[model samples]
Target: MKIDIVSVFPEYFDVMKLSLLGKAQAKGLLEVSAHNLRDWTHDVHHSVDDTPVGGGAGMVMKPEVWSECLDQLLGLDTSAGADEPSISQGPIVIFPNPSAPLFTQADASELSGAQQLIFGCGRYEGYDARIPDYYRAQGVDVREYSIGDYVLNGGEVAVAVMLEAITRLLPGFMGNPESIVEESYTGSEPLLEYRQYTRPTSWRGLDVPAILTSGDHGKVDRFRRDEALERTSQLRPDLVERLDCSQLDKHDRAKLGALGWDLSGEHPRRTK
Candidate 1:
């Protein structure tokens, strides 16, 4: 897969060259390039932001600068008006916005299959809304996502967080591909991953769960599955609320029921 990142602080992405991401680049499995948004500026100061039109507290990233950068990156014609978009089918455009929907593992999974991605990282308050609006109107697959509820100074960090999640799912990107299957937030019915253990079963004083050491693989799997349910319920009941009842076996139902889950509803929920 290919990715282009546009940020005023492109140097922040230099770390992309040091890890498994770098190895993927070496093997030709991925291509990532970070460009300075200022490169598209024509003025001496290379100004990319301006006071908000509505008298906001912080400066808003200028739409004109973003348009020039995004247009060239998206292969859209600057000359083309709102009626006629270059209509690129190959690359999907993404912008990070604090007010947008949360970026999820499911989204990352889906985007891992894209041929190319262009990420525009906004600084100051944010880029003008029309940037994404105009592109979407032109038949482009434009997406805006927030990493979380909190705000960040810029989108560069959010882009980095999202890129790691998406790129690691690409085929051959991970050394052990199976590791991706059972991880938390994966699968049609996602769950928090079971706790991991390694080395001496007894570390200091705390002992590993005895079931893990037993020679019975079936029992170990069952134990892990049960632990996953319990852990997720304790940590992220929101995931539990969305559990697909059809996918739950009798044992699974019993386990959740024991944990105060009310299975009688149209959807699973914790009555308490």
Candidate 2:
């Protein structure tokens, strides 16, 4: 996969050169590049922001600068030439903003399969809304996402957070694909992952669950599923509410009942 980032602080991505992302790039599994948004400026100051049209506390990112940078990266030329494909044709464009919909693991999974991704990192008060609006009108798969409810100084850190989530889902990026399957918020049901332990059976007087060390694979699997259900029920009841209870068997229903789950709901009728 190829990822391009446009930000004033391109150096913020230097950390991507370390750890799994670096290895992924080294192995030809992924290609990531960060370019300075200021590079597109024609003025001496290379300014990329301007005061908002409406009276606002912060300056907004200039759309023209973003347009130029995107055009260069996407090979979109205004001059009449061979019918050149628009950059939006191949790359999914993402803009991080505090007011946008929250980013999700499911979104990362979907984007992991894309051929290319382009992130427009906004700073100050964020980009002139017209940037994404213009691209979307031109048929670009544009998405505006927020990492969480809180606000950040810029989108650079959000871009890194998103990139890490998407890249790890790419094939061969992780040592074991099963690890992905069993992780929290994955698979058909979005349950939190079960607690895990390794190495010392007894650490600081806390011993690993006996079911894990029992060598009874079936029992261990049951324990994990139950733990995941319990954790999700306690922490993310919203997720539990959306679960497809029809997928549960007699044994699963009994376990949920033990946890005080209401199985009388139309979706999960109690089995005789």
Candidate 3:
């Protein structure tokens, strides 16, 4: 996939050259380029932000500068009619903001399938609201997302977080595709991944689960499933509540019952 990142602090993206992203680019599976938002500025200071019109604490990114940058990247004619056909098949545009919906693994999976992506990394307050509003009016696939509830100084770090999540899902980006499948929050029935152990049979007096060491693959599989269920129930009951109980077999239901999970719609009570 081709990705274009427009940020005032383009230098912050240097970390993209270090790991899986770097490998993906080297292998021709991905192409990433960072552009300075100030490059579109015509003034001596190359200023990209201005004081809010209604008077706010932080300066807002100037829409005209953002328009120029986006137009250049998309090959659009700024003077053309708003109803005119887009100059190019525009890439999916992403704007990271604290007010938008949360980004999720599902979103990463969807975006990884796109052939092109463009990220607008906002600084100071944020992009003028009109930026996305204008593009969306032209039928462009524009999305505004937030990584979490917290705020950040800028969207540069958010872009990196999103890129890493999306890139890893691309085919051949990961050494083993199975690694993606077995990870938490993936597949039809999402659940936290089972705990893992490596190497030492006995480390600091804590031994690896004997079920793992056992040659009985079926038993090991059952053990892992149970552990995953137990962990998810203990940590994220919300996930458990969303589960399709009808899909569980008698054995699975019995296990959940043992864990005080109410299978009959009433609140569960521990049975000693």
lDDT of 2: 0.87
TM-score attained by model 3? 0.93
Tens-place lDDT digits, model 1, residues 115-181: 9999999988899888888888877889999999899999999999999999999999999998899
**Better candidate by TM-score, 1 or 3:** 1
lDDT tens readout by residue for model 2, 42-110: 999999999999696989999999988887776665557847435535678999999999999999999
Off by over 4 Å in 3: 80-87, 265-272
lDDT of each structure?
0.91, 0.87, 0.87
Looking at model 1, the pairs that clash are none
Which residue pairs in model 3 clash with each other?
A: none
Please identify model 2 stretches exceeding 4 Å from their true place.
80-89, 266-272
Ranking according to lDDT, highest score first = 1, 2, 3
RMSD of 3: 2.5
For candidate 1, the 10 contiguous residues with the lowest summed lDDT are: 80-89
- lDDT of candidate 3 at residue 162, scale 0 to 100: 96
Per-residue lDDT of model 3, residues 226-249, tens digit only = 888888888876677767777876
1 versus 3: better lDDT goes to:
1
